[model samples]
Target: MDIITSHPRIVKMKKNDITLYISTFPLETEDDFLEKLKETFDVEEACDGKNMAECFAIIYGGIVISKNSIFKRIELEGYFKESDKGIEFEINRFLENPYNCYTFDNGTICFIKNKEKDSRFVDNVGLRFIIK
Candidate 1:
């Protein structure tokens, strides 16, 4: 899939010194796969504390696709302890879905379909996000 570097209204969030990137899944600009994301994730902008949170509906082609939310924060000693647990819990809860899965590489989040055999339709998907 192609990487989208920037967009007009993407949202960025920072917690415990770790940055979170969030953005809308463009339905028309890319290909049909993104359209699927738009249909499933219903990504939109919103606010969470001083940070920005993207509200999304997880859907797959007219079907309500199951999903989970993931948040990652820097594991600082006292100042960020609670925040780290909350973020990790959220990520774990989202990953528990049978049809969806996610992984964090360093701090980058990757959401994927949990299927044994991969198809082109699934392989063609891309994730959208913004960094502060």
Candidate 2:
């Protein structure tokens, strides 16, 4: 299936709904991915994919947030709830994991979970590229 059409946001969006610009695409490499990210977000700065953590920094809600390889999941009493500009969804499936991309502090980029069930990063290209 086409990545954009099969994307959760695309599949779930309604005609008159307010939503955030969340989408996923095939990831190629840190450099290439950063290049693509620049197209949407005003990326202030990024770390060298080899040090501290393979992280990307962007301004969201007027705050700079960075995502790195460190991942921790909290148990939920029910399906995980996430909302964006009134758009919401219950997370219960592998595909419903919401965020898909993860980068290690060592410069490695991969899925945060269910790597097998998800797509693959082939020849420097990753399986998922997420924008939130």
Candidate 3:
């Protein structure tokens, strides 16, 4: 995977003491992207708040974990996999799914995925933010 260092968010976030990074993993096809996405969700199924600080949000294919913030734990109650529609179906519609906001407090984790993964961006995986 190639590193996308020139993304605007990366530049802007840097000044704010937040780090952003994206991987250039080719998104060959939407199907492939969904599969990988499902895997990612599964791997991060729960944010038990083992060692959180303030609050965290999963935005646009990146994770923004903020320390000394105002959150304690994020409830994973309505995550895609928890939908009644089924994980596969929900995963397919994730791009436009409305239950996108997942917040946790005291040092939780968030995952970001963005439009950059579209063919317009050469189907490269979206930016993945990991702020300390």
Candidate 4:
């Protein structure tokens, strides 16, 4: 995040852009999940622990977590998945669902979609915010 000024939260974005997709593989407890999201992710989900953890979210995407330090952890604790390509494929598939909206911080806040398996730029470029 490139900082232009402090007050309004304006920052330069990236070129290729990166989207971090997060998820809990077989959650321990719904109660814990809700509290964790509320505390850590600042996200909330209705509870009851009635279904598998997958039901809580789809693709569980987020941002800025694989910055070398994070990827260093092992399976017992590390967040980054072992297979990135696999995860990318899965994310591409996940984005295909109509309910999902794929976006990027590529120099501008852009709402995008998967045009093909590996399409980078969208035709319309969708909605964007250019920092003047």
- lDDT accuracy of residue 27 in candidate 2: 26
For the record, the alpha-carbon RMSD of candidate 3 to the native fold, in angstroms, is 16.1
Roughly what TM-score does model 3 have, to 2 decimal places? 0.17
Kindly list the per-residue Cα lDDT of model 1 for residues 31-125, writing each as its tens digit: 44344444454333111122222222111111112123443322111110011112231433543541322233333233333323321122112
List lDDT for all candidates, in order. Answer: 0.28, 0.26, 0.26, 0.27
Top candidate, metric TM-score: 1
TM-scores for every predicted model: 0.19, 0.18, 0.17, 0.18
Which 10-residue span in candidate 1 carries the lowest summed lDDT?
75-84
| Candidate 4 lDDT score at position 101 | 33
Report the poorest 10 consecutive residues by lDDT, candidate 4.
Answer: 2-11
Winner on TM-score between 1 and 2 is 1
Error of 3 at 64 (Å): 7.2
Give the runs in model 2 whose Cα sits over 4 Å from its true position: 1-14, 28-33, 36-132
Tens digit of lDDT per residue, candidate 3, span 25-73? Answer: 3322323323444446432332234222211222122223232343222
| Pairs with backbone N, CA or C atoms under 3 Å apart (clashes), candidate 2 | 27-126, 53-105
- Taking all chains together, the TM-score of candidate 2 against the true structure is 0.18
In model 4, what lDDT does residue 61 have? 18
Q: Which is the winner by lDDT between candidate 1 and candidate 3?
A: 1
